[model samples]
Target chain A: MFVLASASKARQKLLDQIALRHKVIVSDFDETQLQEPDPILKVKLLAKGKADSALKKLIEENHALNTYQALLGCDSLFEFKGEIFEKPINKEQLISRWKRMSGQSGFLHTGHYLISLDNSKSDMESISQNNSCEGVVSTKIEFMNLSNFEINKYASTSEPYNCAGGFAIEGNGGLFIKKIDGCFSNVIGLSLPWLKNNLEKYGLSRLLLDR
Target chain B: MFVLASASKARQKLLDQIALRHKVIVSDFDETQLQEPDPILKVKLLAKGKADSALKKLIEENHALNTYQALLGCDSLFEFKGEIFEKPINKEQLISRWKRMSGQSGFLHTGHYLISLDNSKSDMESISQNNSCEGVVSTKIEFMNLSNFEINKYASTSEPYNCAGGFAIEGNGGLFIKKIDGCFSNVIGLSLPWLKNNLEKYGLSRLLLDR
Candidate 1:
């Protein structure tokens, strides 16, 4: 069994499509604590934090799941014009974000980490005898010129507030995107390709068989 | 009524999502006739050719629908390492293309033409008007590394053979994408935001709403 250290529906949906059996465990770390100019590093740190938190939680609860094989943690952020646009706080903030993003381009960065857990410390050391892998994937997005009315109408759906950059690429907000220059799933809040690649490192390619 | 000048399930699914009412008319133009180094130009030319072909067919058939306002034509191509990768010609070619793209970054260019059929009086005028509003939107895609076994497995599904660039960003191909850098729909063979923008320019926002 694998543990997913996130509450994002997009990430869960991606894992589900791949037919991976995973249990959801939301991380307890506060993302605002991490500060970095480079969006990639910030997201990577958050993913790492989530993984560590999940590991600690399982230990504290003395859960039998400690024998589980792996834990996956993920985090994403929207970077536009050299600034990071985190999740919005309110409708006005979402509207303002849309106004600023009108006819502009941006990057969506998703960081992923895979942590291997073993019941015995010796087993963990044996697996690490080779190499552990972790990485970040980024998707670029171009916004079409949007009018105030269109922006307001989309914002009213309240889908943008919970998503980074105040837009959910897979939902109603899809209409505002002029073009995408990278992985569509990354903007949806996870990178399925990246996950598949990492899973291969563990000799776990069987998970991808057509259902 | 709107006329769509192409037969692509991906594009059809997009229009359906937006609830746009339209009739599909497959183009009879020979795509191999065009020679262009720039992928953007290639797709735009193909799209325009398709629009022109559809228009001619409509006139020759003397279709009863009189007040059709807008006509849409679309084309897409896969670009990798400066080379344009059109749809795979055979199973072997499709497998090779999938192998090459298993863990690489690429771009998908989708061109759209929204022609105002009601405004076109003569064939010359129709061609001129079609050229004015046509544009290409490019979406970037990055794939994660896959082993030969995984590549062969995905290829066996035969999903990549019919798709431009040998992968469907919205279907099983989602497993291979690490991130997308532009419009998700563009990679799927349409650009909803671009379509919406063009529609709004003609005071046809109601088309989207009325759906």
Candidate 2:
């Protein structure tokens, strides 16, 4: 079995889409601790922190080697016009962000960190020394011009409140996306291509549990 | 209600994803009659044909005006190395196609056709003259290198059999897609932005049956 170190439902559904045998174990780490200035590095650092924190929990529970083969952590942030945009805190923020983002292009960066529990040693020091993989993928998303009414109506829906960049590409927000210029899944959450590549490299492709 | 004039489940789910209230009415159009050579035009003509056929069916049943607001038809084709690919005929063909497609990039073109039932005239002649919209969207898709075993394993599944380009970006085949360089939804079946644009233009954006 594999473990996902995040509580995002989109990420969980993405794993299920690929038929991967995985379970969600929300990381205990505080995401706000990372105030990294660089948009790309901010997500990367947060993902790494989440994975490490999850690993610490698994080790403490003495279930690292036997129950799960690996742990995956991912975080995404959007950069528009040299500004970092995380999830909007409220409807006003979301509406204001949409006003600025309408008819514009932005980059969404998703950082991925994976820890393999293949080492014979179960100690914390040994796992850190032995197995891990990291990568970041970005997708350029363009939105169509939106009128005030369209933006307000979209904000009224429950789709945008908790999602990164105030939009969910796989939900109602899909109607506003003009086009994407990179890994589509990366924009949604985790990059399936990136995940498959790493899983194959670690001889964990067998975990697909394809239905 | 909006009518979908094709048999593609992906397109239906796409409309649903955007909270659109639509119904499916698979066209009885003979797709093979069109021998169009241009990948872009091939899909466009087929989409138009399907919509026309479905309109004819609705007209015959005298249900076009009262039961639905519009009908949508879509068709997709993949262009790789100057050749057009529809669904593969068999497993051997699918495997061979993947071997050529692996580690390469290709274009997926999806054509969209919509017929608005806003006009009061119910006869076939009046409908053809008054309300229709057409467009085509394309996405450049790149594939990751796959070993023979991986290719064969994927081919053994039912995912590629009925899908255009011998792959489904929303399914297990997502593992093989490196990235897409255009509208991601078009690669699946319909272009959500395209549909939304046309719908909004015709004052039909209210079709969104948001839950």
Candidate 3:
């Protein structure tokens, strides 16, 4: 079993797609307070922060953190024309983002951190020395050459407000996507192939197989 | 307003994505009976046949076919290593197809036919001689290197049984897709960019704008 250290529905849906048994635990990490100059390191640090925060909470709440073999955390960001974009907070920002991103290609970077728990350790001090693995998946996504009317129309809807880069590749905004150049799952929130490759190292690939 | 000449849920969902008001009427044209050596011509002919059949059905049912500006028909096929693949008939075929398609790239060809309906036409005969426009959008899709266990596990699901090439780019099978190189919507059964560009020529792009 695995514990997911995030609250994204897309990540949960992805886990369900692969039939992975997992538990969701929302982290209390404040992402807005985190910042870094490098885009790649930024996401990696955030994912680590989320995992650490979630694990700390589980330990405090007396949850069975040691029962699960692995704890997963993830963070994603959109890079368009040298600028990094997080989720648009309002309709105006979404409209502006779409206008700049229309007919353009951008990179979506998702970072994953897996904390492996040692069940043999009974004390919190020993658990502090747990092994954590990390990986990053980047995908290039191209948006359709949208008209002004189309941009405004999509911005008026609530779809863009809740997604990174003002669009959801798996939702209604899917039609506006022109193409992608890497792991499709990474664009959705996580990379199954990347996860499988990492999980193989821990001898947990069986967890992904058919029940 | 537009009339859709097929019953594919993906196409309907795409129409809804773009906020296009339309009605669906399944074409009676038998896809199995239509075949052409050239993949492009094959899809175009089938799309034309579907549009023609759907227009005739509307006239028979007295559904005011002339009121609509355009009647859209679409058909898609997957070409892997020069062979055409439609929807798999059984699980065995799906497993076999996935074995050959794993870690490979394929072309998804979607043909769209828009029959321009002139409202001035009072009878079926004039409507029968209406002008029609056609376009074909082909997308290159790359599949992840999947293990036999993964392939078999996904093949057992109902997602592979109902889609062309034994996989759906928009469903659970999406995780298995590595990348796409053209119109993403084309792989989903309709090419929105192609459709919007074509619709613009008929002065009907407004139909796609805000209601």
Please name the candidate that would achieve the greatest TM-score relative to the true structure. 2
Cα displacement (angstroms), candidate 2, residue B68, comes to 1.5
Scanning candidate 3 chain A in windows of ten residues, the lowest lDDT window is: A120-129
Q: Write the per-residue lDDT of candidate 1 for residues B70-158, one digit (tens) a residue.
A: 77889999999999999888878877876787668888899887776555555643553643488898877878777787778877776
Query: Residue A118 lDDT in model 2?
Result: 51
For residues A93-173, write the lDDT of model 2, one tens digit per residue: 999999999999999999999888754455665674478889999999999899898899999988898788999988889
Give the true-contact fraction for every prediction, in order.
0.67, 0.77, 0.50
Candidate 3 lDDT, B1-211, residue by residue in tens: 6899999998998888777899898999998797587888988888888988998888789665557788899999899998889889888888888898889999999989987774546566555355678988899988878889888888777777878788887676776787787777888898887787778777777777345
After the best TM-score superposition of candidate 2, give how far the Cα of residue A27 lies from its true spot, in angstroms: 0.7
Q: State the DockQ of every prediction.
A: 0.42, 0.75, 0.44
Candidate no. 2 TM-score:
0.96
Please tell me the TM-score of chain B in candidate 2 relative to the true structure's chain B.
0.96
All-Cα superposition RMSD per candidate:
4.7, 1.5, 2.9
Model 1 interface CAPRI class: acceptable
Error of 1 at A108 (Å): 2.8
Q: Order of all candidates by TM-score, from best down to worst? A: 2, 3, 1
List candidate 2 segments past 4 Å from native. Answer: A62-64
Where's the lowest-lDDT run of ten residues in candidate 3 chain B? B120-129
Please give each candidate's TM-score.
0.77, 0.96, 0.88
- State the lDDT of candidate 1 residue by residue for A1-211, as single tens digits: 6778999987787777566777888889888777788899988888888877876676666557545667777888899899988898899888887888998888889888777663445443333223345788887788878889887777666577889888876666778776676667777777777767676667655656545
Cα lDDT of model 3 by residue, A101-159, tens digit:
98889999999988776454666634534567898889999887888888887877777
Residue B174's lDDT in candidate 3: 74
